[model samples]
Target: MFAVPALSGADDGSWMEVRSADSRECIMAEQRDERLGRRRLHLRLRFLAGESTGSYVTRLAARNNLPVEGVLRSMGIGPMLPVEPQYTEMYLSRYARERLANLAGYTVAEMQKRLVGLRDEFLMSDGDKDDWEWPWDARAGYIVQACSLCAAQRGTRSPAWLILPDPWHVCLRHHRWTDNSRSTQHPYIDLSNLKDVVRAQQRLNRLGKHLGPAARWVFADACSILVRSGYLEDPARTEEWAALAKQLGEQRVRPLAQLSRLSLLTQDLAWLEVRRLYGELGQADYREWLERATRRHGFTFARPLKEWHSQHQPLSRGIPELFSDQSPPSNVVRRATGHELPSCLAAVEELSCLPWVRLPNTMDRLFL
Candidate 1:
């Protein structure tokens, strides 16, 4: 369950897993082909070998007296890979999969089943091979780091990184809807701030029971819109909530607080409103626009998203904007049939195999 150093390419990458065998802790070794030849890598690990939930990077950095990012680069994996771990599969070849299975004690059948399971989870067509890949879009658009609580349950504060394709605020078994990664830099938004949001998340999960994962994108966009309104508030739209924000101020409420307070029926109503109004929206591509818009206006996700969405209640009418704080034009068009056209909200002229993370830009800002 290590995020460590992963490599992403359209093709040509290999990886192996070495687990504790007794704990939830594990390590991943990755390799990518370079023009100079395959890059050699050996993360400095303290203690010859033992069962521990400590981060290999953290320990490796400690052993070699280097920062985690430097150690990752030494391994030929991008420093950002730890934050977006699953991108490794972008270049992970079939040969790599078979090799990894052999190392992890999983049979070929088991590995095939895992791949099949991921496909089923994403509802991708099975017959597409050379042309098939996980729809990294239609997802929360960030890597899933270790669950702090799950790790604590097993006795360690170190990260136990895992993949969460649609982390749409639903964790029935764990009874939590937020990412509890123990990252000091880009930790998750604290869920304890608004308990009602957790309930709303449960309702969203129920919506998923019928609508499936597509509903997740809908709800996520709604939250994104709600969060965006806090910074680039539309006066006409938020007239009703203006007083509330003044009353609660920035400290007393979260931009998403209103979404949490919505009744179950209203939550469904809002989801419907979002689906109908959105027409065609890509939740995967918007955060960059949101981040840039906020930065241009001198605000950060922490400032507004952590404060309040200008609108006190969900709108009954009007199509929601996927990547902007402003409303969409009246003549906005949609793709033919039921297909969704890609969005350039973030100016994706040069699309990379690894989708830039969709979280708020954390480059200089603390929350990406």
Candidate 2:
């Protein structure tokens, strides 16, 4: 029997009593909730590197942050015990949970019940036992973890549980209607959690600042948001974009041309900028388009520094030499210096191979 320390600060509190040595009672309420089928328990814990009891307590705590004495007081745990403290602190996950629970001063059972309550309120309702896990299953865990990862990577407060996990999965039903990326995760419930996931996705996209797939995702998500919010009708904007994309693909025209035409038609200035920044257009073509855009729609021509850099940056800089062939690099057409390089050219030395991709008569290496 181990004794928990008495509280130094005196104040009337409701959770200070437990029966002192009953493991079952420590989380009995949660077990009951699980048995009742109202909620499912997910315990997250971090334990001291190699302690047993500490590990167990950590597990319990992770499931719900509960104070040690409060957890044992009503449970009849002894005030003092003969067990070595080191022996109790060895389970990794278990200790993690216990630490969480202790910090929050909540017993396993109480936290379980609360989670059940949350499920009842937030999860989708289905009439079957197995089907009832909507929006909060293992996939939900993946989404949450994804959110955590995005938060760590991007430093945003977006909800992770609604977005797809690594490898970027999406439901066919949801993604097929538009240009959104397809995810491999199935049986998605696009309930409230999806909003949080989008927030995280948007945050990460912003952090990426129009680089790699991050910029693409941001663009896609913005379109999706407009469609979902009824600002743009379903299949209308996407339909228009698709139609233009198809026309361009059939004609072997560039993607920017397609995007710019669609943006002009849709009255979305942002998309027009997207087309300009991501189109890999030549300086002459860009100037022509800028003039055309301003004449047709009174659009401004200022380029943000980040957007300019993304459009004009060299593709061979950070891209691994091996994978550069799989996709055409964005920096092939340098917007800033009006210099264009061969699409596959990796070095200034390669410029001599194809003089047409460079200035008409000059052989100097041009920085974009």
Give RMSD to native, each candidate: 15.6, 21.1
Q: What stretches of model 2 exceed 4 Å from their correct place?
A: 1-161, 164-282, 292-368
Q: For model 2, what is the error of residue 271's alpha carbon versus the real structure, in angstroms, after optimal superposition?
A: 11
Cα error, residue 274 of model 2, in Å, equals: 11
Please list all clashing residue pairs in model 1, or write none if there are none: 255-307, 255-308, 255-309
lDDT of 2 by residue, 1-368 (tens): 33444444463343344344534222111111111212223444322111123223323433454444443332321232223221211111222233334443566444334332122222223332221111212221112112223223433232122211221222222321111111223112232433333444444444335343323332333333232233232222345445643543322112222233322322332333344444443556544654454455333222221233243323223222212336434464233223333321122222221121211112121111
Sliding window of 10 residues with minimal summed lDDT for model 1: 344-353
Evaluated with TM-score, which candidate comes out highest?
1
* lDDT tens readout by residue for model 1, 180-287: 233355334445544665777677666655443234343444344333445323322244345534553332223334544223423433344344445532343333
TM-score of 2: 0.21
Instruction: Report, for every candidate in turn, its global Cα lDDT versus the true structure.
Output: 0.35, 0.29
Worst 10 residues of 2 by lDDT: 359-368
